[model samples]
Target: MYTIGQVAKFLGVSRDTLKFYEEKELVKPKQNIENGYRKYNRFDIYDITTVNFYREMDIEIKKIQELRKSKSIEGIKSLVDEKEQEVLKEIEYKKLILKKLQIVKEDCEKIKQFLGKYTVKEMKPLEIRGEIEHYTAYEEYETLKENTDSLKKAVTLTSLRRVIRFNDEGMLEDKFIIVRKVEDFEKDIEGEIVSHPKCMYTVIEDGRWSTGGKNTDHNVEASLRKAAIENGYKLLGLVYINLLLTTYEDGLERVFLEMYVPIK
Candidate 1:
């Protein structure tokens, strides 16, 4: 027989916890009438150990009570199976959250690297599945609002890509296309299958636009045109504007955009 204090010490539990277990009828201890003290036998100690084990597994107190009353092996197995399924679902949800966090981290890194640099590089053609809308630069936001549903569905399903056409003077024309990858594309999606051509591209990081600065996009376009001419590379096809990041500060909207102008 062990006193309440001795059992509490041995089991790494408090004396009050043992008293509560006794109150719940989880463990029965004999009372010494002569001294009015609680004395726990080996059986009570074993029962306390069982309760502690289940508690460590995060089993609820009510479920643990039910488990204590049940004696069938099959019943215990069924409970364990249910708990296993719940654990697996939690694991899957955590994995999805981790994936989203990783994507955000990568975007932050890309934004940091592309602050004020312009470069020309070869890029592979991109295949996307999303709705395409034709609108001039002046009507860009209005068109986006009109196609908000399509944009939401596409963004929810995959990554975003912007495709824009330019005129003879290297100015953005009145037509544009927005698309996302087709891997997660739904069959009922009302969008065009567009491919961004593979070629050498004049890449400009439009960090200035993020701070609500004026003419950032125009500056980038002029820079690309100047670079193309200086390097003797012929500008071809539509210019694709990829949004790297967008944030709000001091009641103003900031945008980090990248322009990919295909060149030869």
Candidate 2:
């Protein structure tokens, strides 16, 4: 037998914690009848050690109490198995976040290499979902809303399509279509699925006005057209802008994007 303080010191726990276990009926220490002083025996020490083990495994105190009274090995195994599954799920979730962080770091690194540089590359066929703005129906809207989870995890890229056509006023008409590049699957997805082949690729920084206070989309389009012509390539009507990052620099909101235009 040992005094409460002696047991607490040996177990690396506080005397108050030992008292708490006694109050919870987890360890029934012998009490001095005259002075009502607590005395812990070997059995009480063993119970304290077992309770500490269960608490380390994140088992609730009430559940641990029930487990102590129950002599079912299968029941205890089931509880531990549930905790194991929870840990596995947590590990997988953290792994997904780590992968996303790596991809983000890689994308940021590309700003120096690809910004303002033009090259022709063979872009793989992409499966995209979403119609051009103003042409999307109610059913299409609901479909995009329904598969929200897939949009977060499985989608490769979120992009915008701009048609390089002029309106009746001899001005460039802006028609921005929001789309998401998804995994190629045989099962049909909602909205329009688009594909592209070889493209003229470049990275562009937008959202900043020129010194003359003008939108730079026209200048970018002209530059791409010039590059295409000079390289013996033909513009295939539309530009696909894959958004990379939206950030604030020099107190101005700016967008960094990877631009792709199909070529013949």
Instruction: Name the candidate that leads on TM-score.
Output: 2
Cα displacement (Å) at residue 186, model 1: 14
Give per-residue CA lDDT, model 1, range 4-42, as digits (tens): 999999899999888888887888899989998999899
Candidate 2 lDDT, 206-258, residue by residue in tens:
76532233577768877887898799987777676667776776767677788
TM per candidate: 0.58, 0.67
Clashes of each: 1, 0
lDDT of each: 0.65, 0.71
The TM-score measured for candidate 1 stands at: 0.58
The model with the greatest lDDT is 2
For candidate 1, what is the total of clashing residue pairs? 1
Alpha-carbon runs more than 4 Å astray in model 1: 14-39, 120-216, 227-264
Clashing pairs in 2: none
In candidate 1, how many Å is residue 88 off? 2.6
